[model samples]
Target: MSFFYNYSANNQGLEIEGVQGQSVFSVAKGKVVYIGDTFKNYGKLIIIKHANNYLSMYGFNKNIFIKLNDQVSENQKISTIGCLDNNLSKLYFEIRFKGNPINLLKLFPNIKLKQH
Candidate 1:
């Protein structure tokens, strides 16, 4: 790991560490906009566009169930947790309002996100 990566953790998005095979769900109702590993450190990523110009990103996914333009519901199963390394998986989740990353928990205060 580089020195920047170690220090940049604070600025990065939320990380939910877990093992493989854990289910990953859509945090909001939206249409699947993009899916792939374009973000190098994120492994497999999914970007969904929701109403009111909000976007939710579910990253580090191993198995994806939704495709481009697919209508997704809140809490719907979208994928399975993916490896962050050779032995562990994690979900790197975030929210964006008009393309600006925002504090996810501040917006979804009551969301009961699962942990591993």
Candidate 2:
């Protein structure tokens, strides 16, 4: 599964601020299986295979600093933030459990969003 953000005239991917030039750290210690441009729209992407048959996808990366089969530590920088073909600088992040997409926000209870 995938989550899509509305792209209006002003709503660019860069809306996800504080992530620009920020390290795309690994959520957990894992082994990198694929790194590089896997999707055209995503620009550069990286996939990590972790324990318990889990995998994470990070897309829209400006640069990929890791290689296939490379071991990555938890919170390690694997790639830099980038934009889609539409020039939206957003980081497409996803967590898959057995090839199923899960809401990443549910995993972190400490992160709270202010009410509008």
Candidate 3:
């Protein structure tokens, strides 16, 4: 789904469905600022702060391999894909600038997003 997808709660990111346990990689090099499952709806989440006041979020992770404050490189395996209550596996990703959500497609025009 696109970042602007509307649901019960506003979707602030892009969602990519995949098989359970698929690898999830970081989009850029940054510090792992937050990593936890506290947000019930997000599952195990990881937020990275990058250069130029950008932040990337990776949600619905089954397992997170890195810890907070760790430096991560682009394409690094950070977590495994997680499933929803109905057993649908997906990765919820977002990129924010100055605390506002930005459309992933607008930023990465080369990405071919799947439409459901």
Candidate 3, residue 25: CA error in Å? Answer: 0.6
Residue-level lDDT tens digits of model 2 in 18-111: 3456667888999998777656655676889999988888777787888899999998888778755555456766678787766555674454
Q: Which candidate is the best by TM-score?
A: 3
Error of 2 at 32 (Å): 0.4
TM-score of 1: 0.79
- What do the candidate models score in CA lDDT, each in turn? 0.77, 0.68, 0.83
| TM accuracy, model 3 | 0.84
CA shift of 64, model 2, Å: 1.4
Q: List where candidate 3 sits over 4 angstroms from the true fold.
A: 1-11, 109-116
C-alpha TM-scores of all predictions: 0.79, 0.71, 0.84
Give one digit per residue, the lDDT tens place, for model 1 in 1-116. Answer: 00111114333357776668789888889899999999887789999999999888877899899899999999999999887666766777777788877865666566555542
Go through the candidates in order and give the clash count of each. Answer: 0, 0, 0
In candidate 3, what residue range of length 10 has the lowest lDDT sum?
Answer: 1-10
User: How well does candidate 3 score on lDDT at residue 82?
Assistant: 86
RMSD in angstroms between candidate 2 and the native structure over all alpha carbons = 6.3
Clashing pairs in 2: none
Q: What is residue 78's positional error in candidate 2, in angstroms?
A: 1.2
Task: Please give the RMSD to the true structure for each candidate, in Å.
Answer: 5.8, 6.3, 2.9
